[model samples]
Target chain A: MNISGKNSISGMLKTILQICFWGGIAFLILLPILLFAIGKHLNSFVYVLYPNGICFLIFVKQFIELFNLLKENNPFCNSTVKRLSIAGKAAGIISIILGAETIFNIIVIKDEITSIFILGFMCILFLGVSIALYILSELFKQAKEYKEENDLTV
Target chain B: MGIIVNLDVMLAKRKMSSQELAEKVGITPTNLSILKTNKAKAIRFSTLEKICEILECKPGDILDYIE
Candidate 1:
């Protein structure tokens, strides 16, 4: 089978995503310990980090699956659609959590406009990604049906 | 699924094995099995023509409409 450049790129991206996945896990586990060791306390740090870390991990997993599909040259299969849908749902949940965090920040730290803006921006970014992924998943489903029909057309 | 593929019946009537028909029709045996088992979603005109030519039969001989 002739491997396309797309597969090569996806393979590289899969490696990067795997690195990010493990790095994120390590960061999440060590952040609080590091903060305590440094004698610094930030009440919202752990709370924000945990949810965002989980969401990022889920996104990395979805991308890993997607890259594997590309490597297999079966990007339009049902599993790809499922992974995209899961990614979309995870992003949606992350957006909601970010929105809630923004509200909490606004109420608790009234003068921290920079942090609030950043949180709000991330919320919108994740929401947009969620919508795009959901649409892509639908398109993938249609493409998968077409591929199945074509495969059986012989 | 109202359209049924009767390829196996036609092959049996012509005293032909599926593997032999598949070789003559230039399709994989797995694909011929798909058509024979009525699992195929669609058939190409070229493939149908080849199958008909090899089986010495009409397209309708290998396909049937069942309501």
Candidate 2:
């Protein structure tokens, strides 16, 4: 079938939506790493520091690179993005559980707890960002469906 | 400003069910139905090439100028 002007506009819109959804997800994935790196730097002031601190930043940077490659329509990026999103979700859930544990310890243990609070807050922030990424991943999946349907008509 | 998909014609010519075509084309039957009904918004060259190859017909066999 001929792709008329209307079809072209709608196709472009779908492509734009796909980009926005994935780009938004990439930003959300970066947010937690950014927050954690900053938190780690601040922790150095209080005689408490994070172990494996830089690893989070490095992993997230790699994910961002994958996101860019996906934007370029690299075939490998399709599967890689799905895998990284699952990994990101698991990391988020772990962070959230750790945050809850820290909060519980602060309440029950009744010790000097300002540092625990900071870490707990950072974990909660990461959880929020991670949830946003999950939503964007769902959006990407939906956009893929839309593209497939559009493809059939042409 | 009008063209119509003759997907049904191609499918009938090949004696292929929409579900079977969808399986071969790697798309769902619902989408195949939409294409057959001329309700689809776009088509990709690669997908068209695959469909034409499977149906053993030219693009003209499955598409018609409507206006």
Candidate 3:
């Protein structure tokens, strides 16, 4: 199977990611309006989702851009490195926001312990993912440099 | 990067054009331009050998080291 090209794996993945991202965007836009129609208020949990969801969307958008590069058969380019770093930073921001929300839940709102534990767990998970993405971005940056050097070697 | 390719000098000495050299060496004109413009990071030994053989010159005649 081809790694990159018009009909390659990366192209399929890019299409899938585009579907999910647009679907999620639609969901993000419609959910609050639907809830408001039923006269629902902005609960703490729901409010937290807005900020974190935006960050998550940005992360997915970066991945979509990276996959676009792969589909173009130029995965080892500067844009891929930039997109990966942006995605990593988005993940890191999500971790920090979740951590702050968890703290707020414990101190101000006094949410249930199980809920707090769940939020804390998610915070740690995102932190781990953020670190891993950052490492991957660095690896890709080095790979791009090596690829440029190799391409110039004639 | 400090290693400069004086391919143009050797080509001129042989009274050959870049396009002809590119074809004779089995490489693209774009690659030849890259080498001539010093944008290439490195060159393969085989390509160097081919260039030397075609130009009938030594590698040193085409490559120079500048501080």
Best by TM-score: 1
DockQ of each: 0.80, 0.31, 0.80
Which CAPRI level is candidate 3?
medium
Off by over 4 Å in 3: A1-16
How would you encode candidate 3's per-residue C-alpha lDDT over B2-65 as one tens digit per residue?
A: 8999998998889999999999999999999999999999899999999999999899999999
After the best TM-score superposition of candidate 2, give how far the Cα of residue A92 lies from its true spot, in angstroms.
1.9
- What TM-score quantifies how close candidate 2 is to the native fold? 0.42
Candidate 3 residue lDDT tens string, A1-154: 8757545587567678888889778888998898899999878788888888899999999988776676567888878878888998999999999999999999998988999999999999999999999899899999989989988988
Q: Which stretches of candidate 2 lie over 4 Å from their true place?
A: A1-65, A74-81, A107-109, B1-67
Which candidate has the highest lDDT of all? 3
* TM-score of chain A in every predicted structure: 0.89, 0.50, 0.88
The number of clashing residue pairs in each candidate reads: 0, 2, 0
Q: Is the docking of candidate 2 incorrect, acceptable, medium or high quality?
A: acceptable
Q: Kindly list the per-residue Cα lDDT of model 2 for residues A1-154, writing each as its tens digit.
A: 3222333354554455566546555655675577688775333222222222333444355454554554556524245548557646655765756666576667775546776777777787777767776776676667766665655553
The ten-residue window of minimal lDDT in model 1 chain A covers: A1-10
Instruction: Considering only chain B, report the TM-score of each candidate against the true chain B.
Output: 0.94, 0.91, 0.96
TM-score-based ranking, best first? 1, 3, 2
What's the residue-level lDDT of A104 in candidate 2? Answer: 62
